[model samples]
Target: MEVVRSKEFIADCSWGAKDLASMNGISTRLHWTKEPYKWHVNDGEEVFVVLDGKVEMFYRIGGAETSCILESGDIFYASVGTEHAAHPIGEARILVVEKEGSV
Candidate 1:
């Protein structure tokens, strides 16, 4: 058993993550980032939750690009084949749920 405080979560580097759990081939992770993640498409669906701070989420669909700002407690759902990236407003803690080994 373990307890993680998202507000106190910090990483040694940008976009560092701690694996929280894996169930039914789905992985849950806690991530700390102060920079933007690379644009990529996940092999499956992704559930992105902002636990602390803020984030600017960018996504491309049908070759059209769009973005949205997400505050703490906001959730972003990325379906399969969705290309996306996350840019933190400052230091942010995020929870990501997706298929195992997805990128």
Candidate 2:
């Protein structure tokens, strides 16, 4: 058993992550970042949860780009092949669940 104080978690490098769990090829991880991640499509679905601070999530639909700000406790779901990126408003902690080894 373990306890993680998500709000207190920060990484030494941007987008650094802590592996929380893995089950049947699905993984749950906690990530801390102050920089933006490059846009990419996941091979599988993704569940993104903002645990602390805020994030500006950018996504594309039909080659059109759009974005939304996600506050603490907000959740974003990305289906397979969904092109997206995450830009932290500042320092933020996020919990992400997705197929293992997905990008």
* Top-scoring candidate (TM-score): 2
Candidate 2 lDDT score at position 103:
91
| 20-93: candidate 2 lDDT, tens digit per residue | 99999999999999999999999899999999999999999999999999999999999988999999998999
How many backbone collisions does model 1 have?
0
The residue-by-residue lDDT of candidate 1 on 1-103, one tens digit each, is 9998878988889889999999999999999999999999999999999999999999998999999999999999999999999999999999999999999
lDDT of 1 at 20: 96
By summed lDDT, the worst window of 10 consecutive residues in model 1 runs over 3-12
Runs of candidate 2 with Cα error greater than 4 angstroms are: none
- The per-residue C-alpha lDDT of model 1 at residue 79 equals 97
**Alpha carbon lDDT at 54, candidate 1:** 97
lDDT score at residue 84, model 2, on the 0-100 scale: 99
